[model samples]
Target: MSDDVTAWLLGDQLNPTLDVLADADRVLLIEAHGFADRRPYHAHKLTLVFSAMRHFRDDLRNRGHDVTYLKRDSFGDALGAFLADRPETTLRLMCPASHGAAERLEALVDEHGGHLDLVENECFLTTPADWREWTGEHEPGRTYRQEHWYRHARRETGILMDGDEPIGGEWNYDEYNQETPPEGWRPPETPRFEPDALTRETHEWVTDRFDTWGTDDLDGFAWPTTRADALDALEDFIERRLPAFGRYQDALVAGEPFLAHSLCSPAINLGLLHPMEAIEAVEAAYAERGVDPGAFDPAGDGTGVGGTGDTTATTLAAFGGDESSADTDTTLPPVPLNAAEGFIRQVLGWREFMRHVYRETMPELARANQLDQARDLPPAYWDGETGMTCLSEAVGHVREYGYAHHIERLMVLSNFALLYGADPAELNEWFHLGFVDAYHWVTTPNVVAMGSFGTDVLSSKPYASSGNYVNRMSDYCSDCPYTVSRTTGEGACPFNALYWDFLTENEEFLRGTGRMGLMYSHVDRKDDEEWEAIRERAATVRERAAAGDL
Candidate 1:
């Protein structure tokens, strides 16, 4: 409420943490000029941001502080105007998520001649420095995994810990979380906030200002745009979704877009929800009871529509890995160990680890193309025009809601990107524009390192897969025009040939990897004639995708 200093808040940095909002006299919120125009950003993402910023700004003014918001063509122009309007002001900012962003902000501050102070982002579980400290113990090499980094995070945070040891006697619940939803089992729906005037105005503004890729309508738009609503979403998740979340966390169901996933990423990444608050809320919700294992199945017991199908190991774990079962408990937890540990690993371990990995790799990650993939992102990705049910379902969801479940993201979107040989950087940019939660820090490591393996880091092998993997994990393949069993010729799944061509092209690079041995063995077994058929068909798939004939 004072008029002594100015707090400059980026659109994403909406959290009013005490550190970021320390004794500020006023707040300066600017909508970067032509930001959405740079890429075909989802209109829903823009509305969520603009409406949230307006709400935050209005909240500040309601508390008696002056607020200055400039929706300018350029940030430089906004800052110059602000400097001229208000002299003798020091600009305080929480550090931007990417280095490039920080540099741009810094240059403006330097040119304007006002003192600038930058503090670490409070949204993350840990800072880049903290991540670097954690990595210091392990010698830098090709073998470093997020699991080790995640364990270090758990120990440091003392979350889900019984003194020095983990409470469950195991650090991961990934294996237990992979249950497919039972047929006719209805999943719970995520809460959708009705758009008010601010959101409506922002939607119209976005629509008039730019023509973007995603649907611009506000129907079914229900993301949290205020702190109170964000808290409500968090409570809703813990109370309703968290229980089933751990078990069906990886399941991909048609028409069930959010199933058990928290849907809290938008709020947290935007700074309305803090990481620890969510972590603690979920921990508290856990009905950690001493129960009989026979009576209570901790990990849903693989009870899908078909009594018990063959539990084939898929590569979903590479992105979100798993832990071995513990020796201590014959008894099950009130909340399944998989549910509790899976959520804990994501909030405390994986999210923090991903952010740090992005910071450490940066500009190099932006260009990291270990696979040397140079093909254009297929028009099917943007238009949802393909006959493949999996692509249509996933891409259609992204277009309509600007969202997809993590499994769909990995098994469907990212897996296809890896197999199709799309450029990592361009795909990374597309992800940034497409998703509501995407930021430079979040997208680069996820898209390039984890999703595409552009960086010669994270996994030793790229997250490549065929239609068979998708068929096992989802119903999308079941409804597709192509067959999962067919790897070549007419009506064969594109992923089949693309998956083989990927290995054939990168056989030399993959031969050295220990984990690639299984896939490599399969590659070796194929006769020369089979390889020729695969390569030829793969070429046709790419050509059709490029020409929009598919």
Candidate 2:
């Protein structure tokens, strides 16, 4: 097995049957300190990745692959130092999938004057060029927008489809995705497959290594690190959660973290499961139930489950803001197209678009700064003790579980950080540090594109909003002491003042935006005196945030 003397393996390159593993006598997998040094990544993220890497090493060793798992505790670049002394062509190494890893390895080999073999990691469905073509139209002057490009990707990928046409005669079933769950109606209970001894042991090891690595309080943590566990998690989601996922995708509850969430991103990003197959599993499950994905009501179709009674599959597009009496007895107008469109954009448009953006711009895309907002990350991001209920809960959840649903991510966490003008790098680092599934490839784009960084480009405007927005979307405010209605008064929620302040502060940047028009209209309607009061209140909130009073 001399041909297998040296094969480069990455932590995420977990697929055992990959071509790189072929004929390798001694596989070199690095678990470097530098790799985990980008930011104070969440403890769960560090634990999940390191534990998984260790498990992969063990599995490879058991399978007869001579695995050299380097520990930074004793060895300093053991593989690189070993190769440096050997003849130029004696040792062989494979290229890594990520740009950062690839660059680091290339530098090592070049410095040591050793030979290496680079091969493409054939894991993703779309090539880097495909993402480039989608985003290429907009260059230095214009940036790529998510919706326009996402549709193109949909047509190209043929997911949820017919021949050259979208399934259900529509590219997106977004209209049904609006309408908040009825009050007192609870979402389906999430399936929890508590970790067994393997995960428990991994957690203990991670705990011992990085006892003080993240925010205070890390205990009873559990996330699937091995391939088998990850698959089980995906299957659980497909069976129990996928049916109502689209409907409650944006809903948020104070203590409930997994409301109709797929919870598969960690697995998908970690190479435990492929995106195509994971998404397909959900799609297939829905099909097996004969639930017409196109016609099924995202808002429970008036069924008396998921906390509401049965409703019919009436297209919100046709319904047009007319409140349907099919489900709840409450009489509210049909949900707005604006909200519906925004929700849909996150999934069919933005999510898909970010993938293309990552593929197209990587190494370069990660550095793009549209807003140019630069500041060190605020301390509150790391410390869960921040008095702001929404921020504290959201960050706390991420710290403890390495998880947060989309609503908590976008409307709650991102909104506050942007309003505070937190450094994108800091915000990016915080997300990377805390989330179990967060990686540079995913975290960077989400933070930059869908969240605050995109001014007028991918996002029509900053996703900035006040405490009132959170109050509307979730029950988090009910437990909070601060008043959502207050602007500048004592006990006024920080978000209330900051939201208006953000609009007023960034007026020139946001004035002409179509999305900003309504907000501007409200701002305009406010008398000059009222406007002053709001601005002053906002100033107080910012000052308090700066003073760490919030």
Candidate 3:
């Protein structure tokens, strides 16, 4: 709490209003370059982080605070130079989300003869103590349920809660969140922030100085780099996209990349906007829209129609009185219970749960490979040269923009990798380098655990699936070169054969796991000839994938 203490801010901890900065008038920021050389990160990721850090420094200086900004190759050199003149200076920083970051930073500060104080990171909604209180004792290899933790978070924080129960009388509206968009449906325009002088300069620097992956087109750069722009993006999402976000949250379209998905992850992950700020903004929008929870029937069959009286009428009327009609009506309906609940669950439930799970299960989780599949990732993942429409589109999106919707991440990109028998750790590295929102903490659990089923600590089973799931949830199969109906022989969808082959290959490890009986039942029904054909097709697919000829 000393007034003489200097506050050191990481690139991700760009929020100026944090309590850790209140007592210190002098701020230190370092734009380190050594980390970028460690991997070929996306150009947009480097641009956004450095530009946001520069902007935060200016914002603080303009507010009458003395700031010392350093451009160095490493943090050690930066700290050494900063502490050369002022030895034993106390440097305060928020605890970073990555594992062992605080200890590493503290050790660097000690090496430089400076004192370091780690404060709670306010960018997230939950605390380490909150994670501890919810999960009383950590048992090794025990999986924690996200639903139970989600409810616990709601009860503890009173977010989207009516006294003790959830506001909608249901814990989740996942059933109503799977519908695909109607024919000729177009999503709302994604808001893009035109780069200002600083961003353009930073973009140029990132392009010249680093050998980065992904597209280097500044014209298509849309991520926000300032607090004000992040707020605008948040407002834009709530106003224009949130209404239909739930119904089509899981759907994948041919040309539509940002379908009702909030592009707030990069900004939130960068600390330009706090997680609570987004959750509260969404909660406020739902309250102001005056949606009646009674209109949503929990017993109805997933669809937000027919069982409810006026709800169906109102929803249909908003879309020109036909469920399949593609009329572009400007009149926005009240925010659906499913949309509101779903968005809240993402920020409050799943995001928080991922963080806590990573915190508790790391070191081992980072290297966990329960399935032990060790095939190299296909070249198509890097080059986007696949004939399969789903994988091609998903990888192309990541190659063009450092962004893709959660479904594309889970079902398309990671699902393909999981089915194809790619190593979980290698896939994790690909995600970490390719995405703007991905951090070690974020991608480790998602790609390794949830996506690859490397460990059952986060999920019960692998997210492996054949073309049927993709065909049902998306329109990719309609235009794909491979046939969805055919499981073997020529021009068969790769997912079908790989999926069955994966299940058959790993039945001993997966058959007894949670909720996998149905999948195994299908596995049980295949005869010797069918299995032989599937094995042949799967082998062919792997060979083709490895040769980059698929």
- Counting clashing residue pairs in each candidate, in order, gives 2, 12, 0
Best by TM-score: 3
Please list all clashing residue pairs in model 3, or write none if there are none. none
| lDDT, candidate 3, 227-297, per-residue tens | 99999999988877787787788999999888888889999999999989999988888876535532422
- Candidate 3 RMSD to the correct structure: 4.8
Estimate candidate 1's alpha-carbon lDDT, on a 0 to 1 scale.
0.76
lDDT of 3 at 244: 72
TM-score of each: 0.90, 0.82, 0.93
Candidate 2 local lDDT, 1-550, one digit each (tens): 1232477666666656666667665777677766454445556677677777887787788888877677663223655566655444434444444446666666666667665677666445555567666555546434566656657866786655578875556656665554456555566565554655665676566655564345433453556777777788877665545555666667676666777676777766766666666656544553344334323344434432333332222333334433443443222212222223233344445655665566555655566556666655556666676777888888777767888877788887888888776666667767877788776767777886667664344556678787777887777787788888777677888887777777777788778975788888888887888777777777776677766666
lDDT of 1 at 37: 71
Worst 10 residues of 2 by lDDT: 329-338
- lDDT, candidate 2, equals 0.63
Residue 197, candidate 1: Cα error in Å is: 1.5
Q: Please give the CA lDDT of all the candidate structures.
A: 0.76, 0.63, 0.86
RMSD of 1: 6.9
| Ordered list by TM-score, greatest first | 3, 1, 2
- Stretches of candidate 1 exceeding 4 Å from the true structure: 1-3, 137-143, 287-334
The per-residue C-alpha lDDT of model 3 at residue 303 equals: 33
